[model samples]
Target: MSRLAVAGARHVVTVDPDDTVLHDTTVVVEDGTIVEVRPASAGPVDADEVLDGTGRLLLPGLVNVHTHLPMTLLRGLAEDVDLQGFLTRVWAAEAAVMDPPTVQLGATLGALESLLGGCTTQLDMYFHHDAAHRGALAAGSRHVTGPVFLDGPGPDGLTWQAREELLRAWPAQLAALGGPQVPVAALPHATYTCSPERLAQVAATLREVAGDRPALLSTHVSENAAENADVAARYGRTPTEVLADAGWLTGDLPVVVGHGVHLSDSDRGRLAAAGASVAHCPGSNQKLASGALHWEAVRESGVRLGIGTDGCSSSNDLDMWQAIRQAALLARLTSGRPDAASAHEVLRAATLGGAEALGLGDVVGSVEVGKRADLVLVDLEQPHLTPVHDVHALLVFAAGRADVTDVVVDGEVVVRGSRSTRVDTPALLARARDRAAAAGAAAEAS
Candidate 1:
């Protein structure tokens, strides 16, 4: 069996259930599962190869719970706008540019960025899912992706009937095109875009397909005031209430909502009772003037929560470090309490909380033995990270994507020394530039 050891980590932020932190530790991996986590001072480890983790902070790889991965090509295309206007312009651009090849190129670029930034897994909702799967694989990232359901034909020209077929067949399709870690999930865009009938159909399809294993249904809910108003006007209830009434919020299938910025108190109770999680996208919400997540109430209600970057088009970057910091600050500002969301809480939201949001808690959330080794090593020897006192605080407040020196997914070294081992950076850059230019010109012409 293949084995590897990350030896002598200055600190390992295990993000375990107890939030354990280990000093001078070695996390040993066999095949892909973590076999042992012991003190580096104990003894020599028997492994095929050993990676020096001295002066490094090993953390569970960040899980990005909500993203339109291929939207990387649309970054800065729709800026300084609210959700409605942003969607109008961005959808136009996507329609003009989001063919299979453009989608593939954008996904490749996004995946490379995500992996280099220490995000090992993602819950992505976008078009041309086959290309998205391939791109995330090339970066050695675990991913859950499926057809996006909208009321009308989307940029991919997939109709309502076609989307149903795609959603029903998602598991087999992903298996056929499998790589690193393939998990089946459904992503219906949102209540604003999809009707009640559509949501019911999606929920039914998901239930049918998820016979024994759990399936995840990810969607946007209560993202902004306008969404709430629109949803209420259309369905005579808030977005959260509409979802609850439609029977989408249930225990059988896991549901992860993106950007529940305006979820009501009662909505919180419903969500918590149904065992659904929310992916808090502070960066995108703040940028679009949507509103910050009410972390105080959400946490108090006992709902599962995680941080997300949303999509590059709205958030301008897929950097999870920035998302963590943004979430911390926004929680403080919105809650009107300095101690509302601690650095440690925000850090867990970025890692383990995100894993639970993606229904990957048992597989790739923490550095516990028997879990898959999806891990990141941050270079704490950097000038900024020098003299670290509070490790979790420093990680949430000071560290950024640049500090990620190495990333391993499923015990495989995909990033080393600040670069992706699985991607050709220069060639990928050139390809993206060419496609981006073409996409830009197409958008301009449109």
Candidate 2:
């Protein structure tokens, strides 16, 4: 069995059930699972490879519950626009530039960026999903992606019948594609794009294909006031109610709603009762002028909450550290209480909450024995990170992505010394630049 260890961490933020913090710790991994979290004084550990973690703060790899990985090529293309206008411009660009090969390229670039920033898992929703999956896997990300359903022919040009066939073939295709951490997920675009009947059909298809394994059902919901109004006019109910009526919020299948910026009190109650989770994308919401998701209200309503960076097109980057800090600060501003969303609560929302929302809680959320060893080491020797009085507070209020020095997914070090071990970064950046230029020209022509 392959063995690796991260030894002598200054502080291990376990993020366990009790939020345990260990000093001078060594974490041992064998065959991709955490075997031991030992003390530094507990004697030397036997391992084939060991990474020195001294002067670092060890954490569970960050999780992003909602993102369109292939949209990295469209970053800054749709800025200063509302959700409706953003979609109009971005969709046109996608039509011009987002073929399967380009999708893979963009997904690879996005995944590389995310992984280098210490985000190990991404619940990505995008077109050409097989290509996106391969691209993210190439960057060593625990990518959660599957078939996407749309009301009409989308950029990929699949007919409704073809989409159904693709959904039916998803399980076998996912198995063959082979991401050990990937789950079976059904991503319908959104209520406005998919009718209620189509939503029910998609749900049934997901149920049939997923069998007894718990599947994830994710879609956009109430991302802005206009979106909510449109959904209400179309279906005579809020987006949440439309989903509930379609049988999506039934708790039988795990549900993750992306950018729930306009969810109502009643909607929050239903989601909490149904055991669904909301992915709060504060950066995108703020940039697009979408109303804030009442962070305190959502949590007080008993709903599980997680944080996300929607897509680079709207949010401008995939930086979970920024997202975490924004989430905490935005909560305070919206809730009118300084202590509303505490540092510990927002940190958990970024880590364990996101993992659970993706239905990978049992696999990779915390630094616990028997879990897959997806970990990150943040260099705390910097001036900005100096004098760490409260670890969680420091992480939430002060830390940034540049502090991430190493990242490991499934016990393999994909990033060391802030550089990727999987791909050539300079080459990837050049390709992304070329692709982005093409995308820009496409949008201009359109």
Candidate 3:
């Protein structure tokens, strides 16, 4: 039995049922599952691998529920634009250079960056999904991705029949592209890009693929006023109404709405009644000047809320720490209250909340015995993290990606000493720069 132990932690912030915090804890893992979380004073643990956690804070690895991993090549391609303008520019650029091999290259770079920054799971949405999945797996991440549906020939030039074939083969494809535990996920681009009929068909296909397993449906929803208006113009209904009409809201699968920034009062009620979750991407929303998600209203609506740093093209980075901080601060600004969203609340959204949003809550959300060991160690010995008053506050407000010292996914150390162990960092960055330059040239030529 493979065994690993992380001992002598200053604190183990378990985002568990009661938000338990243990000081000087040692967590033991066997064959990818956590077996014990004891105290440092309980003596040493025998294991094949040991990670010293002195002066470090252990946390459940951050989950990014909404991302386009392959878009790392277009990091700065669509700056200073709203959602509509941003999509137009990005789509044009994507068509210019987003082949499967390039997608794999960009995805590897993005996954390596995410792992080094302490995020271990990503629910990614993009075409050429098989390539994206392979790329993330190469970086040793729990990448949850599957077939994507689009009404017309999108970036990958897939037709309607090809899309269906891809959906039908998704389960086997996912099994072939092996990695850590990952849930089946289906992504429809958005209400504006896909018609209501196409959305229903996509839902049906996902049902066919999932069979007896739990699955999730994620899509862009109500990201901005203009998007809602566009959906209304096309379908005579709001994006929420369109999705509800297609049975996605009330379907057997749980829904994860990306950037519900313009959700109306009635819309929030619909999502809450259907038990759907919303991925609150505060950084992307603020960057694009999309309206803010009402923190108090959504909380009152009883909709599960998770935080995400949207695609690197939109948010410019997959830093869950920044997403956590932006979410907490935005909640205060949007609710006009000092205590609108607490540090613990936002941190939970990044960890357990995000896991729940992706329908992997029971698998990788918290630090519990029998759960998969996806964890992060934040070095509290930094000058900026000195004299920690509240652990949650320090993590949400003060800690940056630079403070992450080690990361483990599925009982294996993928990152140590703030570098990815599974990736060649220097080579990945070089390829990313070269690909981005080529994409720029291709776009200009087009």
Alpha-carbon RMSD of each model: 1.2, 0.9, 1.0
Instruction: Give the Cα lDDT of each candidate.
Output: 0.88, 0.92, 0.90
* Greater-lDDT candidate between 2 and 3: 2
Error of 1 at 164 (Å): 0.9
lDDT of 2 by residue, 1-446 (tens): 99999999999999899999999999999999999999988978889988899899999999999999999999888877899999989999998889998999999999999999999999999998889999998999999988888998888888888888887888888888876576789999999999999999999889998897668999999999999989888778999999999989778888999988898999999999989999999999999999898899999998899999999999999999999999999999998999999988999999999999888899988999999999999999999999989999999999999999999999899999999999988998888899889999988876
Name the runs in model 3 displaced over 4 angstroms.
none
Rank order (by lDDT, best first): 2, 3, 1
User: Candidate 3: worst 10 consecutive residues by lDDT?
Assistant: 437-446
Question: Per-residue alpha-carbon lDDT of model 3 for 1-446, expressed as tens digits?
Answer: 99999999999999999999999999999999999999899999999999999999999999998989899898888888999888878888888889999999988988988998999999899898899999999999999888788888998899988988887888888887778978778888999888899898888888988898778888999999999988888888889999999989884677999999989889999999988989999999999999899887898898889988899889999988898898999899988998998888888989999898888899998999989999999999899999988999999889999999999999999998988888888888888898899777765554
lDDT winner: 2
Per-model TM against the reference: 0.98, 0.99, 0.98
Candidate that beats the other on TM-score, 1 or 3, i.e. the better one: 3
Error of 2 at 312 (Å): 0.4
**lDDT of model number 2:** 0.92
Residue 140 lDDT, candidate 2, scale 0-100:
90
What lDDT score is found at residue 114 in candidate 2?
98
How high is the lDDT of residue 80 in model 3? 89
